[model samples]
Target: MPSLITPVMPPGSLNASAQPTLTIDDLLVRPWLGSDAAAVARVFQEPMIQYWHLRKADSEDEAREWIEQWRLGWESESACHWAVVNADDDRLLGRVSLQSIIMVGGQAEISYWTAPESRGKGVCSRAVARVSSWALNEAGFNRIELSHSTTNIASCRIAEKTGFALEGTRRRALLHADGWHDMHLHARIGEA
Candidate 1:
């Protein structure tokens, strides 16, 4: 039953230590805190966020549960979510995550959302770049993918800015509230 290539990264590579707190200028990309529940809820209420991300927190409790799931994701190696906060004020600015992680394959999919006021200020892209670099160079991931609705021009720009090359378009790949939408798949491969 074990006649195959070795796992690119063994289990516990991520859970063996504390989730890293990454920094870029005034921004701190750290693990989600329970106190961030309210801020997380508020951001999900944004029309654009809901339209694209396809979920709303609805309440602080629900947000807390989501935060807990992200915490558990670190141990499970299924996902990693970081809350992007301003170092000076500790205000929530955005989120970046690696979803559908596969340690044996050393791969994951990147997802992100920025608060309304933080948009157009370079926060999301900077955080994404930092996190993606960490995942590729530090965390032993061999490839990280980013996909967005084809119509999401802003997301397309962010993916390109973070060095994720356009792979291809997946027809009707994702289902949002409106309907099924074609998605553009972008990816960055790492030496690890």
Candidate 2:
């Protein structure tokens, strides 16, 4: 049996080329590097990051392991993660990722977080919008989805800013540290 829509992108398509660096204003979005472990670990230590993400890198080694997973995801065409950096000083600012990729279906889920210092400055939203556009227009994906806990008003605003339409909510879709959360589902689809 075949899917009604043929594979929009073949497996290994993303792996075939060097990941390109994307830009938004003064920031650059590039593939994660092993050397970024120290900065990544430091960011993971931030209380807000730990609270929202539910995981922390207590050591640089753990951060490196996470980086390695991103590398492997590229090789396997399962995900794409980029580190957002300050163009002038090369300071780490945040991250944007397309995970749970399904090439045959041309879809993926968007994930993102901004460094505490970069929050409230539109970094995450701009980075997410840029990455989502790239994924749809250049990376061969037709649909990209963003979901966040319903209580996360900031994320909801980002989704709206990035033009991801509210598709509805999934009750108790995610388990957080405190309890299960109903998640708001948003999606952006490329023009057919």
Q: Compared with the true structure, what per-residue lDDT tens digits does model 1 show for residues 6-56? A: 888898989999999998999999999999999999999899999998788
TM-score, model 2 to reference: 0.96
Task: At residue 45, give the lDDT of candidate 2.
Answer: 92
lDDT of each: 0.95, 0.93
lDDT at residue 26 of model 1 (Cα atoms):
99
lDDT of 2 by residue, 1-192 (tens): 766766989877799998879988899999999999999999999988887797899899999999999878888899999999998888999999999999988999999999999999989988999999999998889999999999999999999999999999999898889999999999999989
